[model samples]
Target: MNAKKLQKKIFPLPKQVEVKDGALKLDKVALKITADVHTAKQAAAVLEKKLAALGIGVCDCAKTTITLALGEAPAQVQFAEQGYRIAVTADGVELTGFGAQGVYYAAVSFVQMLDREIPCCEILDWPDMDFRGHVIESRLGSDLMEKEDWFAMID
Candidate 1:
């Protein structure tokens, strides 16, 4: 969907709409959505769509990064069969990391969070630290919260 169309869908009430000129900025440097051995093609597909929706794209489909074994890590610590770590920097957003569990969790978080309809635009973001980031999914499905109400009506 286009950004204008998306904005309308997300914030429907006409009165509540507000426009800002600089709200959408494209980074001079390309956005890098990298993943560490992002093995699952299905999961990767979802991530690709989500990033595009967020107005971010891969500068180079091949970027080197890291991966962590979920089973090897303790429960108290964030773990994944694989991991999914995404970051935003001054230049653009980065898919900094991912693995088994991480990929699954990142899919859920991103589908829910990233704007799924940003038109050709730019963004400025940065990683808090060159460290670890994690996302967790208790249940897996297309049950995004915002769509629950819409789903109920359809059902």
Candidate 2:
């Protein structure tokens, strides 16, 4: 699919995105991945393993043209948790986040992008909040709790 069509496939849509003209064909690119922190490094390793399954290997030599950086996002970028940015250019892919968790999410987004065959695109995204909560109601609560329980708890 073309990059434009694949953009919508990403979850929690990126704040900004740009689809470029050229695609990063895995078969034609020499991909290299590196990270500045341990967490990001581990994430890169995970990506390495996944790509290996597809017969793509990571390189550290000078010939490496497509570099994937799993690292902390610059301080200016605001997403604190589970927020990330991914940019895919003709020459390389750069993934950044506020911290380790963000870095992981960045990788996740990248993988999602790849899954959709979206080869050339740029994305800027971040979560609005760090915590999420959900509530559920059930009639079984009445059977499980006694009046004494409610009075004792109230005390």
Candidate 3:
């Protein structure tokens, strides 16, 4: 597929992307956390749950493994505090993040990319702004929002 077509599969649009010639099959996969990457386990847990809900089994014997790690971007690539890079290939996927938040974001994107088909690509992305928030005015009956409602909104 073309670059634009592959990019359309992702939300918020990554800053840099290079589409490749093949796709990765995620029918069954494993989550691998690199050494010293503390936050990656939590992010992988979230990813595991998300994948399970979609009928994707997580097992140690799976051939396709999603590896998460905390590392520096290549010298040519510049990433903000919450930046991440995702490299998807036929063999597996590598998610490298700058921080804990970046790891979470990378997992989020990976989940999104799992819809339909996952093309082989490299994505380098970072938020344009430091803070993202949502405001609920009291006038709009925000007081009536329940705990479950808030959790759903956050999810």
Candidate 4:
């Protein structure tokens, strides 16, 4: 079967991206997730849980690796609340961000990169918009808004 080429389809596109190869499966890699701060630790835990759910093995002692770390990115002043950089190499992968939220976004981006299996690549990214939020407003209508619906929406 033909392999899929890496394409730039990520949301809030990275500032820079370079693809080196087509596919890099996650099965045989040693995954390591680390956090430098409390919030980052929480984010790392979430990432680790997600990885576990995917049935991907994680270990700190392997030659081929996937290192997920949460720490202050170089020149933290440049990245806002949601900025990150991720690099996938022959040896392993490295994800870096400015804060906990940044690290979370990095993890998300890394997952997205694995759509067709991790492509050998490098990326530098940061949020273009300073703030992004949405509101769901409802008013009286033919269909009344149920209390249960409101509770679910809030949740």
User: Candidate 3: misplaced stretches above 4 Å?
Assistant: 35-38, 74-79, 135-155
Over the full model, what C-alpha lDDT does candidate 4 score relative to the true structure?
0.65
Write down the worst ten-residue block by lDDT for model 1: 11-20
What RMSD does model 3 have? 6.5
Report the lDDT tens digits of candidate 3 across residue range 1-155: 77787667678787888989899877899889883665677788888888888888899999998998877755554445578999999999998887777887888887777743578989888877788565673336436877787777769
In the range 1-155, model 1's lDDT, one tens digit per residue, is 33344334431111112222222233212222333444434455665666566665545442321112122322423333333343322233333223454544444443443552223322111223345456344345986545565565447
- CA shift of 86, model 1, Å: 3.1
Better of 1 and 2 by lDDT: 2
The estimated TM-scores of all candidates read 0.33, 0.65, 0.76, 0.65
Global lDDT of each candidate: 0.37, 0.63, 0.79, 0.65
Candidate 2 Cα deviation (angstroms), residue 11: 2.6
Among these predictions, the greatest lDDT belongs to: 3
Compose the digit string of candidate 2's lDDT tens values, residues 76-152. Answer: 56656566778776556777766667777777777666631346777777777666445343336457656676666
Error of 3 at 134 (Å): 3.7
lDDT order, best first, reads 3, 4, 2, 1
**Steric clash pairs (candidate 2):** none
> Who is ahead in TM-score, 1 or 3?
3
Which numbered prediction scores highest in TM-score against the true structure? 3
Q: Order of candidates by TM-score, top first?
A: 3, 4, 2, 1
Task: List where candidate 2 sits over 4 angstroms from the true fold.
Answer: 1-4, 28-34, 61-78, 115-118, 132-155
